[model samples]
Target: MTLTALRRDAPSGKADWLVIFLHGYGSNGADLMTFADYWQGSMPNVAFVAPDGLHEAKDGGFRWIGKRPAGDPKLYDDAVEAAPDLHAFIDGELSRVGLDASRLALVGFSQGTVMALHLGLRREVAPAALLGYSGGLVGADRLSAEVTSKPPVMLVHGEQDQLAPLYGMMMSVKAMSEAGIVCQGVPLAGLGHAVNAEALIYGARFLLSAFAFREKHGV
Candidate 1:
């Protein structure tokens, strides 16, 4: 499936990095594209692309997968099945921008975070980093067998998140650690289920650091 996207070209004209920002459920690509404005200055050579998820929401937005009714295995399976199309969208964006997967990063929020981890882990050539805010891994149990490339991941969640909850971050970190993936979690105190200014700044720094490390080692 071809997903809609908002692209922000790098100011440098020669993009050394690509950021695929995935927005949460009931939101569109434009929702997360604003982050490009805040982050582009720090990494002039980086371009940003925020893609809309597959399904349209009832309230005039979009969703990667249908929401499960609490604990439905079928709902979870649907999410797993939908992941490939999202992965394909990422690949298409990279190819269109003339960028390699190694120089790419995946950033997401809430439901988008679930999609990011689901697809990012299974990528043939993993992204430089996967930075998620207010989100968690969807299929943690199958990560070890399904994941081919293990990219560095940073998860930032609010301590008092009611929507996704802080435990989601913990579960994701634990799963990634068991899979031998480098992962870190940052907790924002007195915060809710939303991205804050501090989270955005932290994400920018993490992306920059991950790319710099990759460059230093020639990966």
Candidate 2:
């Protein structure tokens, strides 16, 4: 299946790094592509891509799964069902861009965070870094057995977020730590179930540091 996506080519005309942004449920790629407007000038050599979700929500928006409450037990199952297509999209897009996993980063929001954690962990090769906002790990219980790689991860959530609580991110950080993966969880005070300026700036700094580290070490 062809996945529709919004792409931003590297400003340098040479793609050295690829960053794929994933949006939350009920949203489309265009919603998250706006990040490039702020981030591209900072990382001119990095390309950006944001894909629309696989399914349609009741309100006529795109989503990774069927419409359901966040705490619903079937949410995980919905993610599992949507995984294959997304996995394929990621792989194909990377190849088409002439980049490898080591030069890749996955940034996700809300439900998009669940996809980043799920697929990024189980991918045959690890990404350069993983950044998630307003989201938590979906299959934490199976991670021990299913995780194939452990790239550095940064999770940012709102302390006041009820949709995806800060506590869930805290627990995910613990799980990732126990698994020997570098994990950073930043909970913003007085923020609700949305991304704030602080979170976006923090994410930019994290990505900058990650890619800089990679360049210095040639990793």
The pairs that clash in candidate 2 are none
Worst 10 residues of 2 by lDDT: 65-74
Q: Which tens-of-lDDT digit does each residue in 1-219 have in candidate 2?
A: 788899999999999899998899889999888888888889989999999888777787688865556556687788888889988998888999998878889999999898888888878888888999998787677778888898889999999998888888998899888888899999899998888779889999999998988778754
CA lDDT, candidate 2, residue 66: 57
Candidate 2 to truth, TM: 0.95
Instruction: List model 1 lDDT by residue over 169-200, tens digit each.
Output: 99889999999999999999998988879999
Candidate-wise lDDT, in order: 0.85, 0.87
Q: Pull out the clashing pairs in model 1.
A: none
- What C-alpha lDDT, on a 0 to 100 scale, does residue 102 get in candidate 2? 82
Question: Model 1 segments beyond 4 Å from truth?
Answer: 69-75
Candidates' TM-scores? 0.95, 0.95
lDDT of 1 at 45: 93
